[model samples]
Target: MNERAPATSPEVLAAGYARCAQVTREHGTTYYWGARLLPEQSRRHVHAVYTLARLADDIVDLAGPDPGPATAAALDAFEASFWDAVDTGTSPDPVMAAVATTVRECGIDDECFTRFFGAMRTDLTRRTYDTWGDLLGYMDGSAAVIGEMMLPVLRPGTDAVAPARALGLAFQLTNFLRDVGEDLDRGRVYLPQEDLRRFGADPHARVVTPEWRALMAFEIERNRRLYREADDGIPALPGASRRCVATARVLYARILERIEAADYDVFASRARVPTVRKAALAARMVTSREPMRLVHRDRAALDPLGGTWVSDDPVVLLDDTGSPVGQAPKSAIHHDDTPLHLAFSCYVLDPAGRLLVTTRAASKPSFPGVVTNTVCGHPRPGEDLAEAVRRRARSELGVEVHDLRLVLPGFRYRAEMNGLVEHELCPVFVGWADGDAVAPDPAEVDDVQWVPWEEFRDDVLAGRRTVSPWATEQVPLLAGLGPDPRAWPAGARDALPPAAALGPAAEAA
Candidate 1:
């Protein structure tokens, strides 16, 4: 068990809440919007739970190149610290303190939190479910745990657990359906294997066919059944909380409808419920006076497995902060090592020759306060430079280019990122826009804006523009290429040195 001092001060709790609100507002509007609907007194509690979950989820999903080991270690330490805080009745971390308060206030058991952590840990290993039962089990631990925790806050002394679990499965299934292509591209497939097999489909197999469509339809129908089952528990909830749950259900269910509208072609494109549709769903909730129906279809499914798999051995917390309890005592079993690795970045320039930059979202691992190029991402396993660049440009910028000129090939660069050795053999490409307006992906590019090329170049050279070291190195090289409309291989150029090494006389056109 990790040992840490408890946070009892009001200032620390307030600061923690503020940080939670700020980070959640930037990365997850869905959660932030839901929190806003809660009563003022309950908002902090909800935000605390969201912040902890968000941080844990990002530790696995957004830790950047090779996050596996680090993410697992971080989660382990977080869980240890969380339990220690609960025992001591105080936490040095503000977020943990708020969570502790919420747990106590709402009578939230350790099972829910432990189950949530268990689900997150699955991200380190489980990428696909062998059966629909397996996928529902995953949802029961992940999304359903959240609903179970909220039930106490929303409607105490009520057996709304079964409905919450069903709703959670429905919500997660809808999310999986909508993000099929995106998840598949990330080396993840959330669709159940049993349904895929039943439809003579393999999610991992190359090329999606009519069989895949039938499989998707069957899965969607399963989600609809769960959605109906979950809706029964809503009326049992408090009147104020009922509307929010209804809205969330309607909003998520509409995503499934959108996927159906697209003819279940999730392999080719993603599905989304537009804002207008969301508004319509909310309106329907308000206008319709349908009484909440309570169903007791799957009581056993709702019951959490008995007993925890707790190891008697104590786990140490690696705080890394400069304090007595911060550093974990070095052990003979394992030692940390730093190794050199590669990274990827992009420079988004519009047809007007203006460079697009975005402020890093708070959820990102590096330079969250800093601004960087418009479209940037790390290469996935088995992906080459050109494919990685093209995929990232399309995914992040939401724009495809048919003519991408490889301006600089095989240019190696080295830099230290967050105390880790970063190495890359970058292949810079110049993509010309073809009257397609910019539609930056909010998940990657937080706030996008175009800066004039000459001004951007000057800023880079003059040290006025705060950009990534790699981007700082590539910007001037790209600017020198000018607005030449040439295809790739025809525009290959010699590699350039670091931006600082370039003299002022050479930088000025």
Candidate 2:
């Protein structure tokens, strides 16, 4: 079973995601590689869900001599814990915690889990499916719900659900054909008994006779029909999701080609899609869909503030402890009476240790034309603060900065100018870029300066240069870190006092 390291820190969640990623990459190569196309948020949730399902499947299929009531009891206990986690927004079990978080964040219904476990419980008692309808009935929970659970994470349009189920069934039916011999060895036959009798393919014989080949050919065609039914739903998904599902759909469909290549001899050996083939197909899908993604990138893209942050996009509302409680529209924030919310500030430095500073565009907003750090941004709903900063760096400064370290985790301040307010729990980050010359986006930045760290600090401290109120407060602290941004310690965020509690400093500014 995949295990999560205990802790609720950001580092711990990052570590948990990594562990789940390992399970995905090592155990489900085709699915994992396909998942690589998703955005980070969607990809991690998919990994968590896959890890959960794999754990449950292991209990049902690999319990060996304990595959009776004992296995059933363990599964029941697991389901109970899953529900508990769902209700509480957390779980002591690492895998469940991740799954529960995804379910909560994505708004997936709990009914999907109930239906899935119902099918898993049936695995202990059911042996042979009597007809196609019976096989499909079992597959509904065992297979279709897998696709239903993924709907929220995929964010495909609602009309795609039925097709998603069909696609899932197609994949599961292909697996049944491939695993016929293995299932028979376990005293079960996943193939419907009516199909076996119709094709004269006896489950007891376990041989690749003419009747078996004919039967396999028929079942392969049946699965192919389901794939075609699923093809219609691909357009309903977002670009990255479309690419991901397309890759998985195409790769799984190739299993039929492999089976055919072996003359339908699934019983002799398991027919598998080669790793090389999977890679080639995925590459083709990615390249083919690349242009479409670029066309749609701007509308869904994160702004320089590290969020959609348009006039209508949601800004995360923060509680006293800096935990998110709710959200308000971006246009509704930044007034004289603005509420305390989560925000971020980033400082970008070049390899030569020169700091990149910018003056905000004089587009007539609050603090317009004020000189500040490289760029400051706010987190979008459900976005990680660090990730948002990197996005803002790229979108605003047109510079790629790496290894950003949070320098002030408890940073907060409230300043009012005219009728505009700047009240934020803004964490600070320091990042290193490749060169001193950064291409600034004219819409957000009016002027850019790359100044020696010591010179900039001296000017700010000597009161020889005017800057934003927040910048005035931060420059002194940044100067204490010495010249090289890369040489900054990992515990930098601990060096500063809580920004919100600095009442005197705010008053002076």
Candidate 3:
């Protein structure tokens, strides 16, 4: 090196990036180690993005509950400064300069930051979130957009966008669960109030009660579901980027496991993956082929009813917004903490106006050996729910359904049978098999019966006879339509869930 570059040369950019890296290392060890596997240029861009987010988050969060007008003005100034640097491609502030450079080099969209800063500003005054949907609204801006910002730098295929956003949401949700007590001190509640009321959990008590455990179990499973969503996109990345993201995913997901291992007592102690564990994970990711697979697979084996990887054809998984976040094997998703999924139930009718019901095969998984609706099953990925109903009716009962009218377009429920939970956004249907004989497949149905619709409805309503949880809930609603099953009005086609609004209309095939 005959001559060193002046500070006015490329060294200025290098210094900014170096400073960004130092900030990342100090504040975000998870990110710091994850980015280490990326190529040099890419790694610096990642650090710059993290530094920008970290600094912005500090301005909002560190202001305390009473942020007042001053906090908003300060945040506005920080954002304005960043944008000015972005437009000019330079800044006196080292972190802003590095971030602006990364944005210019990677072509990161300014809209992502707009949404992110909007969300940060929301935190200034918003004290609590009312529902899962409401909370996701905030997370979409604060967390999901950050993933969007990172996508260009990570340089995976465009298909990875949804998964990347899912990873962002998953990471933030984990942080919320782990830091609930800390968040309480800051006058924030990231957990949905609806979920808290449903489980009767009072996090403020800082005690590990049964309600809190149940609530955390539901949330942790949801967090893991997002991780699975994110995993779908990892293989799309180039080698080192894939390794870096995988390492980060596994390490972050492990925090959920830690919360579980500590008996869901998050308030008692902050759950974490130790620094040594993080370093070891990073090392493993570097040397291993398919590092993500082994960690998730080992964790899946811990599930009481196996894991959500039982088939090559995956079942679609939905978030609170009813969007397809990812897909998983149908066989493994119906355990005690079953995540939300798409499915349908059909009531088969004969010419004599009798509703066909069947007792499930004893060996079958989930609500087995119980008398329920004529047919019920998950729609295979890309297969319409109406098509699924028609398919399931044939395979399970050896009959083809005609007049498959969707009777309940928005039916959802959570029920337990023998401690195994079944949950689904199952649309209800009414169809007739016409002349088909009552031939039940021994593998799917133990017995079949055709009871008058009124009798079955009254039986369930009066509790004189027991049936599947969905059947019990459905019969009452089905009865509300009319006396004659054939005369029941079909739900409007447009009322179906978005993913289900596909294939042929709810008409006779």
Candidate 4:
């Protein structure tokens, strides 16, 4: 007999649900209303798609200032990895995994996902469409694919592709008209150029002119026609699915009505459908069931699986504590030469109360991964020596120790590693780790281990350990603290070092 567990873990499923629910509440009020009409299983899947899509949108839209290059690269990587996960049925990225589950469960067309990326890519560079055809092409990739993807989930084998595509385009175009001014402020223009030209309007010019009004009226009617065409396919959808689509259509359509009511003055201010109106639309959709015929149109050119786009390198998922199975420390040295002035040190302590010290990684740019004292750092501006040690210890070794009394402050050391000059004022602290396990965040410490204090001092003195300049300078001072210096290792023993052991110049240097 063979044993098996569930295909997806409960934790993963819960995470997916929470992510989707949060994103839906943030971005998809109307769509969320439609989602309620779905069966529980299908509803979960819809939310998953919404979560993934919203994340993708944020990568381009909300990432920091000057995000164009970074956003573009990230999107390309995400899209490539997304398709790879779909093809292979596994993904390291959580968002992609959720989307893959939705894809597999819903039997959605893969092209819809590709088109979504295509729309996102368009947002990266294109601000205006040259013609109605151009605008439709953008919508096909941006919005139509969403409907196509959902259709499979709503009705497994329905042939309503034509109607879904039309509806998606109609909804998207309406959104463009409504958000024209807002988009323009962000340096984007979604209105079709040919229509602008036809109405003697310049999209780049100010809003609310005679020409703009004419163009708005023309575009609104065009969307209304597309909406009518899309309605024809609604009855063809499964009963539950039709109502959901109807609610979305009616809700979006009101935006166009709002534009008209505003006297086609989208340039002065964008149009929006109020919540009360949206409620009315939802109610009307629930009571109405009209079957309209959809007219099929010539299809646009499909996007090719374009260039060989590279996805991001796989992320190694770790537990909440940031540990991976069988992981080992990666050694490297830190030297400060760059504008950021970055440097770091690691303290290795074992369960036997010994500290293991090693040279930094040879590949590092700073100290070339130099061997260093138990703790090290660059004294940040406005940070005293004691404060710096606390921050570095906690951040590098995940050991939060307080009562950091500085044994020696103002001890300056200099060394050159990998063409970078390292100048540091060594401030040594004796602190105690209160039974806290060391959890090294990889971006800093590479390896750590505890070794006997006597052994560590001998290794440094004998040159067996390639100690950093600061560490080399501090070892003798640390050793002189007691008969068995290991017994007083920094944070452990409470008694302070005798004040007479060092001159004021050495102590305060």
**Best model number under lDDT:** 3
- Candidate 3 lDDT over residue span 346-365, tens digit each: 99898888888899887676
Model 1 pairs whose backbones collide: 6-90, 6-91, 7-91, 232-293
Over 232-297, each residue of candidate 1 has an lDDT whose tens digit, in order, gives: 677776655776576666666667767778777776676765656555555555555552321222
Can you write out model 4's per-residue Cα lDDT over 150-171, one digit (the tens) per residue? 7777783457888888888887
Least well predicted 10-residue stretch by lDDT in candidate 2:
500-509
Error of 2 at 17 (Å): 2.2
Residue 497 CA displacement from its true place in model 3, Å: 10
**Cα RMSDs of all predictions?**
24.6, 24.5, 6.0, 24.9
Best-fitting candidate, measured by TM-score?
Answer: 3
Give the clashing pairs for model 3: none
The TM-score between candidate 1 and the true structure equals: 0.52
Q: Supply candidate 3's per-residue lDDT for 165.
A: 96
Off by over 4 Å in 4: 1-7, 63-67, 84-94, 156-158, 267-270, 283-509
Q: Please, what are the lDDT tens digits per residue for candidate 2 over residues 69-160?
A: 88999999988888877777667666677777777877787788888999988888888899988999999998888888888889986578
| Candidate 3 wrong stretches, greater than 4 Å | 1-12, 295-356, 359-371, 378-394, 397-455, 477-509
Give the Cα error of residue 45 in candidate 1, in Å. 2.5
- In terms of TM-score, how similar is model 3 to the real structure? 0.78
